[model samples]
Target: MQRGLSGQYEIGSVVGQEEVRAFVPAPLPPDPLPDLAGERGRLHEQALLACGRLDAITALLPEPDLFLYAYVRKEALVSSQIEGTQSSLSDLLLFELEETPGVPFDDVVEVSNYIAALEHGLGRLREGFPLSNRLLREIHERLLARGRGAERQPGSLRRTQNWIGGTRPGNAHFVPPPPQRVESQMADLERFLHDDQQPFSALIKAALAHVQFETIHPFLDGNGRMGRLLIALILHEDRVLHQPLLYLSLYFKQNREEYYRLLDATRREGDWEAWLDFFLEGVLTTANGAVETAHRLLDVFREDREQVEGTGRSAANALRVFHALGTRPVASINDLAERSGVAYPTASRAVEALEGLGILREITGRRRDRVFAYWRYIAVLNEGAEPL
Candidate 1:
């Protein structure tokens, strides 16, 4: 369906130096999202089913927030990694503990900024804020607040031309709409988002919104990470999921080439169908993986608890510490003492008991200020979060 130039290109000056053609993406909710019949229909059903399974897992958890907190951090790491950050899940956990050690400060800050940005977006949504350009700017501000790209206009749209890949717009893989047209393009997008007359599924809308946002390249920095975050945010806002759980960063990180190619194809060939198929498949895969990870985490917690129970009198204190570990996954004895509301010695004893049961592993091996990890629990969550 090669509809030709997805949007009009405007002749613009590059830093007032030379003329360049900047691509302005047409506003979204795309007139018609290729028809949702036959194979596409089946993919949609599978995606919905997978989402159902994911939501059900949240219901099964006694304290889904404990899982949600850790899960969101994992997403933050993966999403940031897609933008070339080297922070790992363990680094994020350790960073949150105020322990830097071998972690790169800049990378960890970027990851932390991601967490803050996501939390900000979710908080605003909970307060009944519409997912508009305003919220996007708010999130973008937090994202670049204290990281490497902080100087590149944190919350504002780019005033000068920005290009993706290569050295400059002339040799770049893609050049987004010039700065002057960004506001109007974004306003059109906001209308499409609020337009109820548009006939499109929430999932389809999210997929299209993501690509459109990326194409717009609205911000000077953090557009890629923000575009990816928009997927989960849109779904959460649309009530497609009770919690912001589905993350496709790992899938995108794994299929990096194809992911970029599909986006390019969509812009160059109007091959929305192919992109939609890939997006739905990512939804299906990511949702199912999240469900399985939830189950495995629960199993680890249950099995560890049962082992702790076998320790008799020490079981009660150890169980408390174990529960604390379930929330943080990694902690020092002092942290356990604070989180479990136990004395330092008691927390140490409980940690020792759990360690004896092979439920916790001491990571530092230092007698003083030792840190322990709920190895199995962390392993389950760290499955796809390894540095890419």
Candidate 2:
């Protein structure tokens, strides 16, 4: 339904020269509410069911955090890639272990900062912090804490006009609300998030909130990453899922064109249902993918453990090293020895046995301080995580 422009445009000057009409979005609980009837309703229902299944699978895992550890890094990589970073999952893991000379330092750092930002947000939420503008600023602060965007007022809202695509606001693809209006606009969004009286379900609420955040473009830099983070935060805050397993960056990255188009339609036509359809489908697709990935990882773990157990007298130490590698798929021999509570020589032998069995491979060629990786484990998690 072409319900007309969702918000009004205010005449504003940019770069102290050109005149640009900046958008000021209306507060949330979108008027007429979203049409969650018929097919849209079914999509929402199916997405919720998929979420339930995803959540349930975690309970069966011996260590859900193992999957979360890799998955979170994967989300960080893909989400950063969406914003033009070329960092891969291996680069991130390698960076986490120790800096490698050949890695894209700045790009990987940006991705690393994303992981930090996410962990900080989830940690605070776990400590009972309200998901408000304050938290968003804090997350944004960490997001650019040490990366390429560090000088862009990491934690501060923009104080000047910022444009989306073009060189100047006048020719930009979309100009967000001017700086002066950011605080109030963001406050309105917070109210909608906290408004219990609103009839939107958690899934619907997350979808609406994400578009609003992106449309607002509250911050000068990192707005794209922040908008994506808002979806996971809302779902987690609403207790829709016990763990932070559902991430839509891969889906959004895959459907990049349609994703942006629907967002534009929601702003121009007040067509929330269209965006909701896409959002719910993303939820279903991502949730199903996560569940599938979890099962695949479990199979790898079971199969590898079986192989380790069949190694005769060397089985005990090798299993210990394997468990440690399960915790972190990439590790040095020294690190594995310490983590698995085995002596250095014992850990080295265990790593050698696992390597001989094709269970682990040495990532670094140097004979000293070399790192080993659980190839299959990383391979499974690396799917769809390639940098674009």
Candidate 3:
């Protein structure tokens, strides 16, 4: 049966709020992570295999697909992040496009806008910008660049209280420390980012940061998604992984329940090892998945290039034509015109050229309106994954 999410606004399916402030959550407990999480032997073996496999394939690949991987993953993370009172795992996938029956859609366009900004921020990070609250605030602010919440540009720090879960007005599943507590939370967060006090490995540190930040719930919105992206950022910053091609969302989405449970458990039990192991497992799984995606993408690129080039296009034009692979993976003829910055006739000629050579596959049979797909590459992106 389909989910009955007929309501129009997002609220915690599990967490509740008493009007955002004056919220009270469950009792907090000490750390509960085991030193090795008992499942160590098998998990260790899997980790070794995962690391070796990912590194081997990644060694052959060059840059991150800034257009495909980073951008799409950012979109998923950001949508899942703030979604304020209503966001859910399933909602992340549809937030920007086709409204689903029984599911609410609001500020959809804004999600894309912020995702673009997220891409911009990631670009800056790769360029060596220092990470700071000001930087993050800027990203959140731009997230409102379009859509319903555009006026919510003051996406700045929260001055009021926010809660994670519950139904009663004053009760929440989780609540951040407080407005005054932001600074201390920031300090801890910053130190974790830059400090050498590796109470554990890079994998473990990543988990610790995630749990701590969620515990802090720094912003009134976007905390969950931002926290997830921050994981990839940390890995890249620390050189734990190359090229942020990871789709940690895939793992978390599959293990959604445990993901939240362990996050909550960290606060209740201080089970650092449990969370660390979980995070590592996610890393191992996603890293391997990403490698497969990369190879699949490369194959599609090569094949698409062949088809476009067979039309006798210049080598340089071949580069531009191959762009159809990622630029607008789903392009209408109009999209083709806008993207290539060409007149309708010129765009038509180009599409016909590729189509004749079997590069761009038409999706719709309609004459008046049509859509074309760079199926090979898109298939790779959409492979093994449903919407977030």
Candidate 4:
């Protein structure tokens, strides 16, 4: 299945200097998709089952959006980390709380922007916006609204040659199409996305679209993060999942070398089958893990709530605080009071009651303005979310 030269190369000069042969990836919905009738078929079945399980779990959550609040932030953290951002989930939570201490402002801003971008995309989809190049540009704008790549022409495609890996195009591992060809290449991709004649499964379309986006390398910066985001966006758009619950960043990060190799292999060897296999496996693994995490979180919340209920007189106020913690795993007393609609002293006493029941832990261990974490809840969501 080694189809030579995935796309034609064109001679182009970079920065008015050396001429480089830049690669322009062929348009998406790759023809015939490597024949998924054997092993690939089995993988596809497993992925579908896993996705069904995830949706079932999502449906069971008391408030899926509340879970999504933290879950999406976790995804943002992991996705940004793959691009070398050092912000942790705690840092993001702290930043969102507007109490930034010992956190890299720029890194946290980048992660926050990622969350904003995702929310914007999901909102637009809900409003019946088509997933086209225009939406991608909009998401890109929000993604780099602040932080490292803000000045890299946030909402626009690269107007010059861009390369991945090495310093210059001449020494780079891969050089994307020259600037002039970006629009035409992207137009082809858009058509493929909207094409009704070519029938492909939602999962197959998502996998192929992700690789094509990455190979196109359209943006001046943030292409990697944007490409990853497109996967979830496509699935959500196609109604494959009710919510944006599946994220492959952790899987991709763990399999960094193979992931890159397969992407390159798809370009070099036309090994779309290998990449699709990997993509489907990631779907299965990530979906199954999400379902398991959801179950564990529900158990933790139930067990902690029962323990809080055993506190008698203080139970009502403490239960209020505990529910708040379920939504925001990390919070301050002020946060608890505001969210729970109680007085500061009341919030403090409620927090103490929960602490006595071993439901919440003081993360800072300070006298005043101390931060408390729903340790078990956070720990359940923190699995595989550690910054790499």
Candidate 5:
């Protein structure tokens, strides 16, 4: 349903410009509410079922947190990529290992901060903190803690006008709410988030909140990343998923053009139903994809363990090192030794054994301080994570 102009454009002024129209989005739950009926209703049900499946599949894993760790990094990479970062899943893993030789330091740092920000948010939520503006500020602070975005007023809401695309606010594709309107608008969003009187499901609420956050563009920087993160946070906070496993970054990245178009459509045409359709489809696709990846990782772990068992004499120690690599796919020989509680030589020989079996590969290509990657494991996690 075209509700017509979701919000009003207020007259504002920016540097080098005498006048600008900054959009202030209307409060959540959209007027007349979103039409989650007919085909849209069916899609919503299917998406919810898919999310349920994704949540349950974690029970089948040997260690759900291990899967969560890898899954979160993949999400961080893809989400950051949408914002024009060139970091890959491998680059993020390598940076975490402190082995950043040829890595794009700035890009990888940005991705790394995304991971930190997400972890911080999850931690706070786990401690029973409300998902309010304060929590968002904390997450944003960590997101821009270091690297290129360090000085963009990390934790605070923007006090100046910000635009998306184009050189200035005058010609930008979209100008978000002016500084004065941000707090009130965000407060409205927060009320909607905590309103149990809402008639929609958690999934629908998440979908709507994400658009509201992005349109508000409350933060000076990291708004895109924050908006995406908001989806996962909402789902987790509302107990829609048992874990933070469903991420739409890969879906959004793959459908980059359509994603942006839907967002703009919602603001310009007030076609909330259309954006909801696209968002539901993304949920279904991303949830199903995550389930598939979890199964593949399980298969790899099982088959590789069986292969190591065949080594006989050295199988015990080699298994230990492999187990450590399973937890952290990228590690050095010393890291393996310490993590596996084996001597340096034993860890070295174990690594060589795994290498011989074609299970692990040396990534650093250096004699000293060489880093090894659980290639197959990393490969499974790297799907659709290539930098754009």
Candidate 6:
């Protein structure tokens, strides 16, 4: 964009326009990420140790339940990301919402879809399938679906140029790598993705790739969400984890300022270690948390079953109602009817049995318009029930 002396606006090539701040590639200094001294001095070791622990967790994956571990981890992530806001860890995990962040439901679903597509793409990358613009575009388009980035055709490259680091027209923070640099940066990163010996650990490689993507800031928007998703994708593709379930949004949401600052420090100063350590630690911590959560859910399911099984109602149907509670906590009898796939009277009987077992609490008192809740199960899923 060209600015007239009187503040008029014009567009032209930055190359020819002296007034435009033409982006020139600067010689990035050596990796200073190692200098993440005090807090994460032992981060490299911690990351490796965490990898070992997570590997053991994966090994515990029995044949039938191998994907179960992956699937539930995926559920935790999807539930959090789809219904979460840029807020507290408690809120993200519990999905507690007293006041809606006003994020549209469509945007939520779109981001979740992108997460799924990235999972698919990462699967291909793991098997040595070549990544193509078409695949990337398809994933990117799906990410943009029904959301803010819908301005552009889904997955189509911009016919016009795009830039970042600018806030207002008059003063922008940083210009993205110029157009010419985009192809090279992308290619180099892709090579790094395939490189077996990059003189760095997988943890470091994850950091480098993340920072590089953000620096490239390739897309118009959804870059932050996409970059985070890529962290999980890389971890899964490299066999660091058996599933693309590791997530850092919880950590990033917690330490948002530091996250941005360390990323910027990479460009302005070269603090690669700091960022890498953070990323690595996030993987381990999030992985452990996920494992614990899955086990907790299993325990909850077992206990709930023992409490309500053989209530003279259909034992399997009662169990189904409990499972449905995991998905919809505040459910009406009609909701139970749909989920249980039983007749209305049968569903009502099942709900009554659960209520007698204290498994469900009635929310609304109207006899006809009654609503029963799986209060305990929801409480287990949400640390504190605020709202969905």
Better of 2 and 4 by TM-score: 2
Structural similarity to truth (TM-score) of each candidate = 0.96, 0.98, 0.72, 0.96, 0.97, 0.72
The regions of model 4 sitting more than 4 angstroms off are 1-3
- Residue-pair clashes, model 4: 0
By summed lDDT, which 10 consecutive residues of candidate 6 come out lowest?
91-100
What would the per-residue lDDT of candidate 6 be over residues 250-365, giving only the tens digit for each residue? 66766767887887776655556666767777766876775675566656656877887766547777777666665555667777788768777877888888898888888545
- Candidates' RMSD to native: 1.9, 1.8, 8.3, 1.9, 1.8, 7.1
Worst 10 residues of 5 by lDDT: 1-10
The weakest ten consecutive residues by lDDT in model 1 span: 1-10
lDDT tens per residue, model 5, 257-376: 999999999899889999999999999989989999999998999999999999999999999999998788999999999999999999999999999999998887788888899999
Model 1 misplacement above 4 A? 1-3, 15-17, 31-33
| Residues 1-388, model 4: lDDT tens digits | 1124577677876554788888877777665457888989999999988988887777778967768887898899999989998877887888888656776899899999999999999999999999999999999999999878999999898888899988788889998888888988988988887787866778888888888888889999999899989998988998888899999999999999999999999888788999999999999999988888888888888898889888889899998988988788889999999999999999999998888888888876678778888888888787778888
lDDT, candidate 2, 258-290, per-residue tens: 999998998888898889988998999999999
Positional deviation of residue 140's Cα in model 2 after best superposition, in angstroms: 0.6
Can you write out model 1's per-residue Cα lDDT over 1-388, one digit (the tens) per residue?
Answer: 1124466677777654567777777677554458789999999999999998897788889879888998899899998888888877878888888655766899999999998999999999999999999999999999999869999899998888898998777878988888888888888878877788877878988898888889989998999999988988888998888899999999999999999999998887778899999999999999988888888888888888888888888889998999998889888999999999999999999988888888889876577777888888888899889987
For residues 208-288, what per-residue lDDT tens digits would candidate 3 score against the true structure?
A: 677766776767666666677677666666666555555476677678799889876665554656776788788778777
Colliding pairs, model 2: none
How many steric overlaps are in each model, in order? Answer: 0, 0, 22, 0, 0, 3
Local distance difference test scores for all models: 0.87, 0.90, 0.58, 0.87, 0.92, 0.58
